[model samples]
Target chain A: DARVTQTPRHKVTEMGQEVTMRCQPILGHNTVFWYRQTMMQGLELLAYFRNRAPLDDSGMPKDRFSAEMPDATLATLKIQPSEPRDSAVYFCASGLVRGTGASSYNSPLHFGNGTRLTVT
Target chain B: DQQVKQNSPSLSVQEGRISILNCDYTNSMFDYFLWYKKYPAEGPTFLISISSIKDKNEDGRFTVFLNKSAKHLSLHIVPSQPGDSAVYFCAAIAYNNNDMRFGAGTRLTVKP
Candidate 1:
């Protein structure tokens, strides 16, 4: 089955550590999105890339969090000097959009099992 | 500020009854809306969606109703089942924007 795959289902690290989460999107899907879920914040968009180029990362903390797609199949989110506040479930989703038209709104995102991050 | 809002944090319903979950949006630019279901440790799954042009969409026992004038929407599950218990999130995409803003999910428990 074509499903988005995420590595390291769970991660535990001390504060000030660098943590990385990886995602392999479904083949042929050009849109990939990263989201953080927490008890306080149900779910917040961290970043998104279209056609392997980042379309927006405005929601991300520029000083600590960074996301990139090294290749079509591999997208990564890294946190440098991870803080305790960064503890949350990180999810990766992918979808296909045709051109720059409004039809992109109709494309439903397919999500992967998330990475549960714990920063102590 | 949160563009989408689910005022109710949790809800409980008896099985075989109707369960209604409400959502409100502040952005008038939103042209598409979607509902997602999530369980512990798993990612959210797309349940149903409606366009700004439509007021209602139904799939199986799940129905979504949109009141564009009120900037509100709702998901109704008839004959609610225990298996339907989960967190439901409301999301919307603005016109010409693919960024989907999500509301704080509402946890629903269907008691048998």
Candidate 2:
């Protein structure tokens, strides 16, 4: 079965370390989203890309967080000089819109298992 | 500010009973709502969804009811089972935006 795949299912890093998470969306899926989940915040959408172009990153912290979709299959979320407050499970989801052309933005997201990041 | 809220942190239901989980949204622009079930260490899975135009939508044993005027929605699971025990998150998507806002989630425990 096709599914969104994420690397480093678990990551542990000290404060001020650079953390990078990678995702491989299902083949041909046109929309990719990155979300962070924590006990305090629940699930927050950090960034989203449609057709390998970022549509929104306003939810992301501008100074340390960055997300990108280099190509159709690859999407990445990076935190430079990550802080302890950034510790959370990061999820990647992919989907294609229904009846509105080939974009995933209009469809329900299919999620990956997620990367559990713990910054000490 | 939290756009979506699931006030109850947890709920316990007996097997074969109906389980009701509620959600509230602050944004009137939210036109589509969804319920997602999550197991530990796994991503949330889509369970049911409803559009603002409809009052209710049902699929098998799962039914989602929407109250557009009240900005409220709920998920009903009939004959709750042990396998149904998991965290349920309520998500809302604005009519004009693709971003989906989620609630803090309610942990449902179905006892035998």
Candidate 3:
């Protein structure tokens, strides 16, 4: 079965270092999303893309976080000068959104295993 | 501020009993709702979903109930099994937007 794939299952870095997480969405899926799960915040949507175009990144921290879909198959989430507070399990999800009218809806996302980041 | 909320942090249920997990949303614009199940060290898996047009949807032993007027939704698992123990998250998508908002999740422990 097809599935979203994420790399670097775990990462540990010193505060102020850069952390990068990568995801390969399921084939034929046009939408990609990035989420972070923390003990306090739970699951938070950081950004999303549709057709390789960013739909929104308002949920992400403008100063340190950036998300991009460089190509249909590759999506990335990067945090520069990462801080301990930024540590969390980052998840990548993808879906093929379709439908219209009463039937219109975003398809359920297929999530990757996630990247566990630890900043000390 | 979280638009979707799962107030309960954890739940314990005996095996073979019914397990109910609840979620609430504040946005009336939200017309689609979903339930995701996550195991430790794994990604959340799509369990089931319900559209605004329908109040309920079912897949096998899993059932989802949506109350539009009350802005509430719930997932019910009948004959809960030990393998069913996991963290469950509630997600919502607005009719006008494709962004999906998620709740804090409720960890369910099925005692065998």
Candidate 4:
């Protein structure tokens, strides 16, 4: 079955280290989303891209966190100078929206097993 | 600020009974809502969804209800089974905006 695939199921890094998480969305999916889950905050949307173009990154920390869709099949979320507070499970999800219409936006997302990131 | 909120952190119901999980949102721009089920160490999976224009949607044993005036929605599972126990997340999406927001999930437990 087709599913979104994420690399490095787990990652451990120290302060000031850089961490990169990769995702391969299902073929033909047009949207990719990145989210962070923590005990206190639940699932927080960091960014999303549609048609390989970044649509929203307002939820992300611009100074340290960056998300990019290098191509249709590959999406990446990177963090530099990671901090302890950044420790959380990051999830990558993909969905197909047929058009800009309201009904098409109802498509549900398919998520990949998340990358558990622990910054010490 | 969290636009979506699942007030209850957890819920428990006996098998064969009904389990209801509620969610409330502050943003009126949201035109669609969804419920997702998540097991430990696994990604959240889509469960059910309801459009703002409709009051309810049902599929098999799962049903979703929406109250646009109250900015609230709920998921109901009839004949709750042990296998149905998991974290339920409520999410919302706005028209023309693919930025989906999620609420803190509610852990559901079904006892035999």
TM-score of chain B of each: 0.99, 0.99, 0.98, 0.98
Q: Estimate TM-scores for all models.
A: 0.97, 0.95, 0.96, 0.96
In the range A1-120, model 4's lDDT, one tens digit per residue, is 899999889999999999999999989999999999987778999999999999889989999999999899999999997999999999999999765535775358999989999988
**Each prediction's Cα lDDT score?**
0.92, 0.89, 0.91, 0.92
Docking quality tier of model 3: medium
Candidate 2 structure, TM-score to reference: 0.95
What lDDT score is found at residue A11 in candidate 1?
A: 99
Please report how far candidate 4 places residue B40 from its true position, in Å. Answer: 1.0
Candidate 1's residue-wise lDDT over B65-103, tens digit each?
999999999999998999999999999888767888889
- Model 4 stretches with alpha carbons more than 4 Å out: none
Candidate 3, A64-112: lDDT as tens digits:
9999889998999999989999989999999887632224444578999
lDDT string for model 2 (B8-64, tens) is 989999999999999999998888889999999999999988888899999998999
- Per-residue lDDT tens digits for candidate 1, residues A1-120, read 788999889999999999999999999999999999877677899899999999999989999999999999999999999999999999999999654424664368889999999999
Over B67-86, each residue of candidate 4 has an lDDT whose tens digit, in order, gives: 99999999999989999999
Pairs that collide, model 3: none
Which residue ranges in model 2 land beyond 4 Å of their true spot? A98-107
| Winner by TM-score | 1
CAPRI verdict (incorrect, acceptable, medium, high) for model 2: medium
Compute the lDDT for candidate 4: 0.92
